[model samples]
Target: MKRKLSILLALVMILSLALPMMAGAETVSLAYKNGSLHLRKGPGTNYGSNGYVRDGDYITVLSKGSVWSKIETSAGRIGYIKNLYISGNGANYADGTSYFGGSYTGYVVTKYSGSSVNLRAGASTSTASMGQLRNGTKIKILGENGNWYLIETASGTQGYMSKTYIKSSAGSSSSSATQYATVTGSVVNVRAGAGTQYVVKTALTRGTTVKVLEKTTSNWWKIQWGSYTGYMSANYLRMK
Candidate 1:
């Protein structure tokens, strides 16, 4: 009985130390407005998407994990989102910086030939496998969840790739040449600047391809669609 009591006390101590960081009533706002951050049903991208939360929408953080946070929206909805997609209070990343979006390009790599990496339909290793990607197969990393990356293949396949076997396509994928991407959301606004307070320049429909120029300090992609050059949220653009 004494031994069990000691163990219980130790567990309580651990919880006491850890709970403050995870549970709080502090208010925060969604950060990555590339368009809107997907509100998830659970802690990771393996969970179903509840919907989307736009940038600057204030939320009450119910709990926080290293990679995900549970929040209550101003509308009183509860959902999960990546920690980097939030800011204001109690928002932080493992690297000590708040960065959202997995907009870079990546590729599958392995030590041996013929060994393919599994791309899962969700973020977990236990999730259903969509397909396998061979070594050197290029992928567009759109977002992240724990140890997996939400990726889209050239043939329009979307899935999760383990970060262990995938690496960023570093050198040849540099920003020198012209880049292009398609808008994923329905009718995303091309703004004069990065935030919602900025004037809306125009609206780009889904499947419309635009020339990517650069990302603003606030993370909006400066794009050129037709003759109009303006900024759009990074969330809505699929970096192709």
Candidate 2:
């Protein structure tokens, strides 16, 4: 009876440790690619190609070895790809460890002004419009399909938006970034319009402080730089 009790206790301890390890497995995805990327059945090129992932193909990263990672596609296909090709919100780790830093995420910014991008039920423009994302509304990207990205607004609205009208950033910015910013880049150009097609007014050297006048609907900051008010790409400005 004593031996049986000891065996049972040992089994419970092993199960307890393994349970959390199994629970920690998480989802990750292949980063954006212009062309098709292949997923092999095993971790190396010697393995057979099992499937392919496109521009916004999201997958679950199962495990990471030294050079390759095992992943599962949305369609349930399992395969491996080079670790360098994988990108995701690092919130969860494949080895059942949690990332101490913030989880990986992406941002969505409007491309142009005067119009809102339709959030649809499907990737195509013809799909049902679930809602609209206004200019400069930052959203957390969840996944992608073709030229469309799956995103969720801060208000918890989720849908698809065309990639053409919205730009994707690697992570979120400080809440005050839209209100005030500092120039981080050397000689950043101040443009007449929100986009590069606009005329260049002048250039601001690094460390210049600018008042946050307005964030144009197209991701440009309309700023006041010592009375020379013009537009600059939001990318170069860091929130004060």
- The model with the greatest lDDT is 1
Kindly provide the TM-score of model 1 when superposed on the true structure, using C-alpha atoms: 0.38
Highest TM-score against the true fold, candidate: 1
State how far residue 175 of model 1 sits from its true place (Å): 2.7
For every candidate, C-alpha RMSD to the true structure in Å:
13.3, 17.3
Clashes (N, CA, C under 3 Å) per candidate: 4, 2
Q: On a 0 to 100 scale, what is the lDDT of residue 239 in model 1?
A: 68
Tens digits of lDDT, candidate 2, 24-43: 34434322223356789888
lDDT of each: 0.69, 0.62
Candidate 1 clash pair list: 34-233, 34-234, 34-235, 35-235
Residue 104 in model 1: lDDT: 72
Cα deviation of 160 in candidate 2 (Å)? 13
Error of 2 at 90 (Å): 24
- 74-189, model 1: which lDDT tens digit per residue? 67678997665566654422121112233677778878987898877456676456679998898876655556666778987666766777776663433344668889898999
